[model samples]
Target: MSGAANPALLLGASLSAMAAALHLAIIVGGAPWYRCFGAGEGMAKLAQAGHWWPALLTLGIAFVLLVAAAYALGAGGWSAALRGLPGLRWVLLGITAVYLLRGLAPWPAMLLQPELRQPFWIWSTLICAGYGGVHALGLAQAWSRL
Candidate 1:
């Protein structure tokens, strides 16, 4: 990895980390949080009923996001150990694709199922797109090192 940190990747890592933290906070905040975060009324109800599935699923997401953040950090040259991770390039590519795909999902949904659209969909799409854009730029900038 280069000695200099890639700012785009660093920002991507921060965004992922923040998302992971938000997921954890949602778990702590319970049903209200689920509802507030647009997790769906059913999920909120399940959480309110003390179902383990909701928290478990959310925790899994948080873990994945945290790992992605770490990978981004490593790829960005912020962490030497992480930079040595196996399949770093492929992993980063997958993460970038996932985010971009998610960001684009709402567009199709908006056309096919406008009734199901919500404010959350719009906001989440923008956020995911921004995250993916940052990751893509960083990945491109650091491609040779990885």
Candidate 2:
């Protein structure tokens, strides 16, 4: 990797890390948080009942976000060891795609289930788009090194 730091990737990493933290916080905040975060009433009820599934599911998402953050840090030249990870390019591409696709999730959902639309969908879509854009720019900037 180059000696220069990639600002885009750094921001992307921060965003991902923040998202992971939010997921953890939601788990700690219980049923109300789950409902407020648009995880659905079912998830909120499960959380209220102290079922393992809600926390487990949220934890899995948090872990993935953390992994994505690590990859962004590595790709941004902030971590030498992570930069050397096998299939880094492919993994980064996959991450970027996932974020972008999630950003577009509202479009299909709006068409298929307009009744389910909420403010969370709009805000989350924008956030995901911003994250995806940053990752895309960072990946492009560091393509040759990877």
**Candidate with the greatest TM-score versus the true structure:** 1
Most lDDT-accurate candidate = 1
Assess each prediction's global lDDT (C-alpha) against the native. 0.93, 0.92
lDDT, residue 92, candidate 2:
90
Per-residue lDDT of candidate 1, residues 18-127 (tens digit): 99999999999999999999999999999999999999999999999999999999899998889887899999999999999888877887879888678888889989
**TM-score, predicted candidate 2 vs. hidden true structure:** 0.94
The list of candidate 2 runs beyond 4 A from truth reads 111-113
**Poorly placed runs, candidate 1 (over 4 Å):** none
* Alpha-carbon shift of residue 42 in model 2 (angstroms): 0.1
Measured with C-alpha atoms, the lDDT of residue 103 in candidate 2 is 88
